[model samples]
Target: MTNDFSPLSQWQLDRARRTVHRGGVIAYPTEGVWGLGCDPWNPDAVEEILELKQRPAHKGLILVAASTDQIEFLLAPLDPEMRERATRHWPGPVTCLLPDPEDRVPFLVKGDHSAIAVRVSDHPVVKALCEAAGQPLVSTSCNPAGRPPARHGWQVRRYFGQGQVHIVPGALGGNRKPSRILDIVTGQWLR
Candidate 1:
């Protein structure tokens, strides 16, 4: 019998990619922490992540992509210099802000800012998930507000417990530092 809850497969991964076509929340690995992600288009799913983490919606979230192209809808409108300026930092930990392409973006994801933070990841699994999912996800550190970020699957399980998440199996990437947060406009590191 196929266990309903075995680790993910290429098929399930493909399914996840397709399912996210409509927008939903998911968890995946990041450089130094596991991250919670969702379809930026789905306000309900984004809201679910906020509720799950007890995160204040106004704090905003990051978006992760398989490639700069995955978020083309959000990036295409940027002036060439602005687009080039932002693309220079990607396929790595540096997240940058770009204009929101659609009104579907919730105020929570934009936080108090005028632009949304996004990145194209270098991590293999994150690349695969976004590649398979075929869209950038609303990426944020996986933890309750005021708690430590989860660095391993077990830590993620311990923090959220089994019922809330469909934990994808993987080893954490060997990065000592979490992704650096910067104001793309000011070049200031917020974290």
Candidate 2:
């Protein structure tokens, strides 16, 4: 069967966005390597991601954005200093855990903590995706535990072998490394 998620020469981005609209998980480039993502607000979409990765919801997931403001819906009481630091790393790879309110942040994406991991991504397509979705998207590497994360769409398709992530072909950012995870409160390394 032909894959509807194939990367068309021009409408790839729109197709990916539509795929998300249809409650599908997707693979696209990130700051370092390719990442799998879906609408964080869509429970069905989120469930797909969890099932695809065999990830536990209690473990939580990271949300990547084009801007910090995109995460305002999930954040609460961001301190002045920490906000500044987060701003300094935004539009780039640096995931920061920020204060979150239970009412605003959903339990499916939050770990056993009061903080929510958020990233202001440096990837252009990621930024556009968030802008298109009008909110943060669940972002995670496109691989299972103990396996290397896929660096390209072909690798993603090869790993999942089809019908996995709705593939969106594009080049990854030049970083060649994953984002650094930081604790917004203690400035501690969690990753």
Candidate 3:
């Protein structure tokens, strides 16, 4: 698949955004694996992804963004030191669990926890998709629970099928493992 954000890439990004806006799930490349994304605010879409993965709602999900600005609403309540510590590892492979004081994030995305897992991605396709979507997306590995994450386009298709998800054409970032998960408040690693 294409790497750079060319015109065709932009077109695909636009289409992906449209699909997410319409409450559709999409599969795209992320730092280490293929990720399934949809509007985090849409309960139906989030439920669809959960059902597709055979994952329970209490496990929660990660929200991927193009930049910290896109998720400032979720980060604004944290202490400056905590915020800095969390964001410092961003634009890369690190997902930080930030506290949501006002309940801005829906329960379906945050699951049974009070904190929301989020990441600012450096992958071009992920960044482009988040930018086009105009918000953080519900990003989780594109594979059913108890299975390995998809590292190839074919694997993504095989896991989700052709019409089940809108596959955004791209290549995975050069990372062997998925993003490390950290809880900023306690400074503990979750993954």
Predicted structure with the largest TM-score when compared to the true one: 3
Residue 27, model 3, lDDT:
95
lDDT of 1 by residue, 1-191 (tens): 11122345787687567656655556677776888877776888788889989988888888889998897877788778777777787878878777675644568778876778888888776777787766778888889988988887887888887757655555566677877666655555677
Per-residue C-alpha lDDT of model 2 across residues 9-62, encoded as one tens digit per residue: 436767788888888998887767788898877888888887777788889888
lDDT of 3 by residue, 54-82 (tens): 99999899999999999999888888999
| Overall local distance difference test of candidate 3 | 0.90
Candidate number that wins on TM-score, 2 or 3: 3
Candidate 1 stretches with Cα past 4 Å from truth are 1-8, 18-24, 101-104, 186-191
The residue pairs that clash in candidate 2, if any, are none
Each candidate: RMSD: 5.3, 5.1, 2.1
Which has the greatest lDDT? 3
Native-structure RMSD, model 3: 2.1
